[model samples]
Target chain A: MPREDVMATETQLYTPSTAAARRTSGLRLSRRRVIHTSLTYALLLFGSVLLMVPFFWMLSTSLKTLAEVQTWPIVWIPSNAVWENYPAVFQKTPFARYIMNSLVIAIGGIIGTLIGSSLAGFGFARLRFPGRNVLFFLNLTTLMLPAWVVIVPHFMMFSAVGWLDTYLPFIVPAFFGNAFYIFLFRQWFMGVPGELEDAARIDGCSTFRIFAQIFMPLAKPVIATVAIFAFFYYWNDLLYPLVYLQSQMKFPVSLGLRMFQTANAGVVDMPKMMAASMMALLPCVVIFFFAQRLFVQGVVMTGVEK
Target chain B: MALRIRMPKTKMARREAMEGYLFILPWILGFLIFRLGPMLYSLFLSFTDYAARGAPQFIGLENYTYMFTKDPRFLDSLRSTLAFVVGYLPLNLALGLAIALLMNQRVRGITGFRAIYYLPAVTSGVAVAILWQFVFHKQWGILNAILSVFGAQPIGWLVDPKWVMVAFVIMSIWGVGGSMIIYLAGLQSIPTELYESASIDGANGVRKFWHITLPMLTPTIFFVLITGLIAAFQIFESAYIMTGGGPNYATYFFGLNIYFTAFQSLRFAYASTLAWMLFAIIAALTIFVFTTSRRWVFYAGAREDA
Candidate 1:
């Protein structure tokens, strides 16, 4: 699911040539270069506008009165940007508890994945234990196994351990290293110059220390990429939280947003739900844009680059 | 620092024996205690008839036998699941690649357009479900509004059993931004020299794309295609929230069926069997992909096309 976003960062740059072609296609203007540049800017402005519509629509709906939201001939702009909905969102439906729960799950997931994947990745790339290739391939095998294949066992397992209604079920497996993250980290680690680790070996640095102090530090980019991925996934998690969490207080934003719809039932509150949904997704979008550089690095060339 | 007495005739430091275990200990423990242990327990329980409350009753092969004969819903859901996977895989790849191609043309403001396309990908599934529900509503929805302009009737997006899968497909299209990113990245990785040479050889855009870009991107596409197919098979959340597997069980997807049987109907034994079957299928499919990928995936600088 995540591997594709890494594709976008580099491929998206080629869009400029469309503008170049479009300008040249339409006109017999002598100053083709200037027209192409202006046309490119115009397309860019258009693209920006198109992109902003959904966010703006979400915000406006969130602010509009309930009546205003359901009205036909949709309101393109809100009379006022309602600051109150944010507060209302928090006030309604244990939103604060859900937010806290999301934060804990997201953080715990990141920490666990970072520790688990880094060690496993380092082992695969640098260490030579028995059945190393087999173990690494076994780890990679998990990549294609859909979560549904194990959801029943996963649910029962957590329930039996009395981990249901707690964050443990959500956070624990992440610590064991996700197959994708381990693969990414190992791919990144494989490129870390052997000379460096060898020098550290001669300096009496432990394998673990070299992994900790040297490889760990050097693998920050991939680590950041994995962290960003874990954050988005945890943030987007619906099935896990839906199954594991029985209590309303334990619900994360993902499940919490669903409640807004289910709570409303047939008489769907399109405005409030849309607004709340938009708010719920803000962190994911923000984090993605912020950590995009790492994502690009992962997609383009990580292991093979060095 | 160089007081190494031949480093005990090994490159590995002595500290590795201790810290190595320490580093992996958390993950190993997590896997054993949280995932692996429970998974084994569930497998054992599947062989027995153990409801959450009742004591275990040994019933080996009963659940599996019942699944093949008595479980009609499982069959239905399996059909839906398979249909969905077939539809979704091609649609996602095509749409994602199309957007990537459009954005790949060196257009100005491509960044903003890329971000817009990517926005829905990052949006919560809950929000997306909500938005899609409204958009696909039989009447008074934006999609219907657009359709009316083209002289088409309103669609029963969330209702009508026949059209239910289409609803999921529409929703899926709204989220192609992430895959678009990956295609974009793959595009960027291809050296410009290849395209330039192709252009000099009288290759037009489409021909160049077919000859160079698509071939260069075969690896990422294959990667996305396999993973995407697996994901498509596990379609639970959207069907759960939007349709609730209703409209006369039109969208009763396999994952949703498992959830209902296990959680709602308290049929863990049956659910586990269903899950196990899915696991086997996924395992087989993954193996198939791994075997075939070598034939088509063209890794950079690799000789003989793989």
Candidate 2:
């Protein structure tokens, strides 16, 4: 049965070696390829549209009037787009303050992660210490440790230090290095040629000097990857901010948006809520588009290379 | 000359070790103070009756006992979270792989399609939740509008307990683009020679995909599955923002329960217990996956131990 099936397929795919028959078969094969490619494109387009519906709805709702948002037919396009909703979001809540808070936290996180992760990663990758391998292994294990386990104690610890309601919790630990980013940096640093470090040492460079000047400069891609991850983590984080920060003014955009939604629940101010969401979403989306390559590299590195 | 060289070599090695220690000092300090200290403290807290007021009175195993035997929300939260994991995981993996396969085709403007798909993954989780909340609105949602176009009645997505989990799953799948990118990377890394050889053996497209592509993609699938499982278990921000743990606690995820217990109820010790339970569940499942992975995950050119 298998032989017969194979023979049938073979006959169907190709005719016996006459030049004219071969030419017709070749045409048929090309046509088949064309159909296959077209089908792939069609499927992708359909998936893309389905995937993008939420985003499209967000944008569409943000531009619509409140009346348009609640209309029966679900207006795909508002006849009179409410461009004022974007600016009005700032007026409605402390949206500007939220954005500012988010930026500060994000920047602090990026700076801290870069410094801490790079230094620690460089140490693990390049230097020999007594318990280096054990320490590195511990770091990787912490990657699997759930954040929930540490959160309550962290809250207590911070409150004890009078650091609650501040950005200290978010920013301080970042300066100490994250397990995943440190791992990423270590992996990248390990790949750097030993010759460079040797040359730097021979030139009378201190270890710190070699790291600051040579390794750090050469790790731009990994640095970009780490920085982007840190930025997004701080910017988008809700649970941490929710647990730690108490003051409304100190809230990041994430917490602020949640507060906004909670405050306006049942009222359903769809346009203004969507406008605020769009604003909150803007920076990360813009950064992603600009650093698309680095993002993909970082994601793939975490998944495939790990 | 030999004595002098040996002395300097020893001195250099010592210096290198000292430098390594210095570079990684921040990480060690952070790990001890932030991670280790908090983890141990939380464990202690889990056995106490701390409420963020005054002193934590030790009340060993009461929290754990209460969770298992008495606490009304505990089982509900666990069941809801597991239901979400069950509903969300397979669909996410399948859809992510499907999109990745489609995006793997050598079609023109493929990167554009990829970027469009991935746009949502980078957005703030809070913002995405808010937008989705609007999209799932019963009376005026675009989703119901689309359904209406097909002569279907409006379904109360977020409002109805029966359909809430489905809504959450659909929202989660919208961001499947992140996994799709990883799968695409895995797909590209596959050696085309496998496909070429399969074709030479008269293997059709479906056979080639099953025999060659699926086996080769197992490692990536394993990676996605593990990470996705971890992330899914920690489903908080979306549920918190979108449903506030529900119309009637239908979306009361474990993370939300932990948060409410810790903050709202001010049962810091009990929250710690809940947190540890979550950690235990995650760890067990992770180990389960790791052990099972040996049978399925394939690595090209990998050593036996690896």
Candidate 3:
């Protein structure tokens, strides 16, 4: 979510003429310049190694034997790789079901956020209304109020409707448009030239049809951005599930992973724990790698563009 | 531009207003039911002793009074959260800016470096807790192993009460990539001409940064500081999963305290008080930041050119 600011700056930094000029300027690098550049790379490489160690350790330990994991001097490599630890995570708990639960919530959240926020964004951006400004202000106010503020009442309200321990609480809210996403969509929609909507209207298209056929089709970038953020949010969310869900069968991978850690607190089964952590983290890393550009765009839309 | 034929202005305006409302209906419903309704209900619940099973028993300002005067846990939670904020926020800002400045250098393969740094932000929450537990394990952990190589005794990172917050702060700083990204964006926006002119005036790298870079990046820093503090104050999942707010509640952050109070103790009203207190703190802090921003946050215009 934070990378988009870099994109905003990058656009300014890397315009064709400016980039060309900078490239030409780089060609005249002196011995001092070369030394400075090497120093910069060295510092960055060192920092990157420090940052990457935990991840490297996670992968390394996941393949280690339980005995190897606890060795003094911290065995950098396992004498015997425990490839079975990955499957053991599933064997020790309902890890597969937990993964399924996480997918359901994350996907559900993405769909709801896309539909709800886009429509609301289209409304706030294009459609003229008497109370539009007021409504949008109200929407922005949600950003100031922490989610925990309403959590108690939300739990009670959901419980009253017999929705506790179900995915309804997590999924339903997404269907109603998140404030930040709505703002993102509104900003994106606002940037779409008014001429397109006007041309569509001239062809006798209704407002909803104009939004669905014209604006929605052109909003793929924003939609993808919202989807990635929503997926990230629901996938890592532990507090909501902790409060509202009680049954093991209903738990998402996040809650399930935490429970796994707590259940095995007395045992030093580091390899299996690392394996479970890896399993839980895999989807997000995959999504991030694939849609890296969209992720950066999302951050830009929310941060610098604001 | 569409259908510019002489339709009555009033009819057209009314139709557009209606269309806007229709498009935004989902958000309005969501706001009223999910956000506003829950907020007001939570406010009401804050004044009553409402267990999950029964009706709310109104008890005036007792909840507020009890939190202020009698609750040692509340104060402890507040103090711990503040300690976390104090430790985490400044380091996050400084490191974020430093890494950003480093990353902002015209270095090759910088994107690859960014992707590596951003790995932690995406793979946070439960996975992070599990990984950090292994890293900070009292004995035979990788961190302790490294400390031993330096001829230093291994510190009990997550065990000893004095050091748990420091451990959490370290974990928090590990994901500074988001803020760093934002800073890169801010740095990018400082017109290159400004730097060229500064260099012309005999400014070195440090002088250019102090004069040109710092002022221009103030807006981004302000944003990061506000959001970072807000996020730190709500630190819960890691504390809950890692130390379980333990070592005699030294790591008991306000969010976890509210969670335990509501879920474990089933004291809904008291929890609501805690939640409101959190909201108040965040809101006050945010407002304070915004108000104070005028003094230091350098907007592009509406002032004298520097």
Best by TM-score: 2
Q: Write one digit per residue (lDDT tens) for candidate 2, span A1-306.
A: 366446655775665555456457667888999999999988888888887888889899999987887779889988888999999988889998999999999999899999999999999999996778888988887887788889888888889899999988888888999899998999999999999999988999988889999999999999999998888898899999999999999999999998888888853688899899998888888899999999899988788785
Q: Write the per-residue lDDT of candidate 1 for residues B172-211, one digit (tens) a residue.
A: 7666776888888877878999988987799987898788
Docking class of 2: medium
* lDDT score at residue A159, model 2, on the 0-100 scale: 90
User: Total clashing residue pairs per candidate?
Assistant: 19, 0, 1
Local accuracy by lDDT, each model: 0.73, 0.89, 0.86
> Candidate 1 vs candidate 3: which has greater DockQ?
3
Q: Residue A241 CA error for candidate 3 (Å)?
A: 1.3
TM-scores of chain A across the candidates, in order, are 0.82, 0.92, 0.89
Residues A216-262, model 1: lDDT tens digits: 89988888888987888888778888878887877898899888778
lDDT per residue, candidate 3, A157-223, as tens digits?
Answer: 8988999999999988888899999999999999999899889889999998998999899998998
- Candidate ordering by TM-score (highest first): 2, 3, 1
The TM-scores of all predictions, comma-separated, are 0.85, 0.94, 0.92
At residue A207, what lDDT does model 1 achieve?
73
